[model samples]
Target: MPVPPATRTSPGAKAPTRPPVRRRERQIGGSQRRMADLQPGLDFTNVALRPYANVERMRNELLRCYLLSPPASEIPEAISPFTVQYISCVLATYPRCMLSDGGLPPLVHRAQVQGQEMPRALANCFSLVRMWYQAVPGSEAMVAGMVEQEMERLAGKPPGQGDYILLCTFQAYLLYSIMIYFSPLPNTSALKYKTMITLSELACRTVRNGFSCAAEHSHTRPPWETWIVAASKRRTFVTMELFRIAFNAGRLLPSSVTSELGDIFASGNRALWEASDRDSWGREHDRYLLDWEDGMLNTSELYRPEATAQKERVERWVQSVDEFGMMLFAVCAHIRGR
Candidate 1:
């Protein structure tokens, strides 16, 4: 097939193929070459960089295993390793979040004036919980001391005080109570359980006094602050109720001590619970209300259609709920024999 000397292909002609080994080499080095060749196009402005990026990664890992999973069949004899790691990350990354002054961290204070107290207190309890779990010297005594201090603080304040502070106090009390109840130490179960029950009663009363049930006619989305406060109150109430049922089982407490679950199903919308920002929250809240008006089911009643052919719908809803919601749902199902 020898003809005139083979003409050279122009640079603009169809691209030539590389040898197999050369192609493999290019594939292996492609990413590195691209990275080396990349140039900045535009600089970002007003971007809020996370101060604890490494800690955030740890938190994400812990959440993926614990909060993202279904509740276990039984509470572990000790806290899970993931929880311990998460607590360590939180303590290391955001030490100011656990300050005992009940003041908000500077960054948090700048963002909002209220609702920061509960989170701070909860963070403190988490730190204490880690210490207790690790059996650190004097950690048990420290937790007990904090419990006493909180009790005294509550006793000194009248119920007529601001609902914001009351809510925060109740939340802290709830966390501390649970911590005490679940301590690994022996010879403390009776006292801890009694304390837990008492705190549960107090928390329920605080909810009733501080937050009103969402009115059936109130179809409009409220401001973020107001909506979040209501949502926290409702969630706290439901959590305490679930704990009480699970702990007491066949035993019945006095009416004054027991929480009435009237209209509890009218809690915050799942979309509102899951929203990350004010605008998104508002959109989700509105969408949820619209769905509600159109006869959407509540989370508590979601499992009622087991005999129906809506298996896919049930699975989707189950996956939609967050960890806390899933835990509550699990408790309800346990109580109802579902």
Candidate 2:
């Protein structure tokens, strides 16, 4: 082999070295730093779950820096792409389908006209949360004190509740958490700590029960039901990531908790997710390559260095991920790039 060209140096100097991929520690969870035993359905109580200081820092940072900051002028590019992408996910999910990211298309109509009390109640509460943001700014803890109490009550509900109810409860806490951090309401100081605890509880509950109904294929379950599972899983994982990055708060969470996010399956196939009925979802899902037919992507595969080994296939999977899934992708990529 030919000798490699040597750099011409007049004086003694160190050779340049490639920079590191990360500095302090690999904060974002993907291919690194996960506990092996902390798989899904395990007893979360056994895990060493501890609250980190970063949650409050993030809550304040987002509220003061992002939400309460003055309106932007000049270029429209003032907004971060990540912020825009996340907003798209929120708008897609809320009011229309409160539980799943991007909202489930089939139930969007039915839930409006003939939905159950829990879902319907969610619809109304969702509107109030949205309206609170739109309405004139005021004090009083963002929402009524009773709202927090109700959410507390809902969260403590028995374990045997239906998937739908569990998901709805998860949504209420999530919505209230948003108001607690971002909404320009008074008394946030009072509810902030309580909200943080509730959030962790909700995260654990969501992980344990939210996607429990999911299946690997449509053969045994209807496309609609699986779609819900897929959306729920994706949303929950991304929310955890958002919590991590939004304040460096996630830095305090144990690797076991963070690692679980990657092990779960994320929904692929946007067409199927958006399919209005069983027939359309079946057809679209069937058209996918055998490997991706179920559209069940192991999320860990998403953050690996060789994640794009299958570029075209990966592209299809990335496109299929819902709004919150996209956020998860962005957060992981953002941290890894650093």
Candidate 3:
């Protein structure tokens, strides 16, 4: 074979070579997934769309969480009359989310909040939080220790009584954590280190005993009871990571709960969650329950909508969730913001 003359090269230029085949093969192979891994032949039509009935109300609440600060719209009286504006308003007026609601009837017969009695644990937490707000005479050690003791009560396995206690305990913990984090009390700093440990214990509990009613919906379980069990667990589980982000991100920075942790629980339809009676929950809410598999509303799904079938059903699921569900949406939205 005859040799060709070499071409001139720039001073810094190096000789060209063939493309990297192995690197490309590895990159392409990583993209490949098994057909069975994708779970073909599944009904995954929703994987059934449970459209939220209260579209307008749901929209308003989502806007409120994502947009409203200092909570101007629903403020009663004048803003000038307040001591602590946001805290006072949140305590008095912020709509109850599942974390706070504990799957109970706030409106008895779907009426007024009077029908539901405050959980005793929560009532006690309120008193403890009061000490934070009022600057009642107490040492940093005393206040932080008191809060720690309360958290300790719920730290290990839940009571033998079951989900009801579990729900209330978490509600109490949520109140405790939020109040301390936002409180002006000197002890708030003391709690910073402690909050991490408390959060870890909570995460373990969610993994071990989080959803007691993770079974398929049936005549055996009342619609309301099952919804409460799952939502409470999801709310608490998500909140722990929510706090973790809030802590690490500066007293002054924040990771989202869902994407960081592979939580697959769904926030079910609101009508079913709020229904005061079994007859009221209706078939629509009952028809699609959170199964352990296809039906789960994984946090990852926020990024991968294609895995789900119906857009409207997803909207309904997103809208139907109580404030706790809205809280998760807010976190997911922040993830996209980053």
RMSD of 2: 24.0
Model 1 regions more than 4 Å off: 1-127, 185-194, 210-216, 249-259, 266-270, 295-319
| Ten contiguous residues minimizing lDDT sum, candidate 2 | 42-51
Which residue ranges in model 2 land beyond 4 Å of their true spot? 1-121, 134-142, 187-191, 210-214, 217-223, 248-257, 289-295, 307-312
Candidate 2 lDDT at 258 equals 50
Write the residue-wise lDDT of candidate 3 on 21-46 in tens digits. 76432211123222112222222111
> Each candidate's lDDT (Cα)?
0.44, 0.47, 0.45
The best candidate in terms of TM-score: 2
Counted clashes in each candidate structure? 0, 0, 4
Task: In candidate 1, list every pair of residues with a backbone clash.
Answer: none
lDDT winner between 1 and 3, please give it: 3
Candidates in order, TM-scores: namely 0.53, 0.57, 0.53
Name the lDDT of candidate 3.
0.45
lDDT per residue, candidate 2, 46-67, as tens digits? Answer: 2211123243333342233223
RMSD for each model, in Å, please? 17.4, 24.0, 23.6
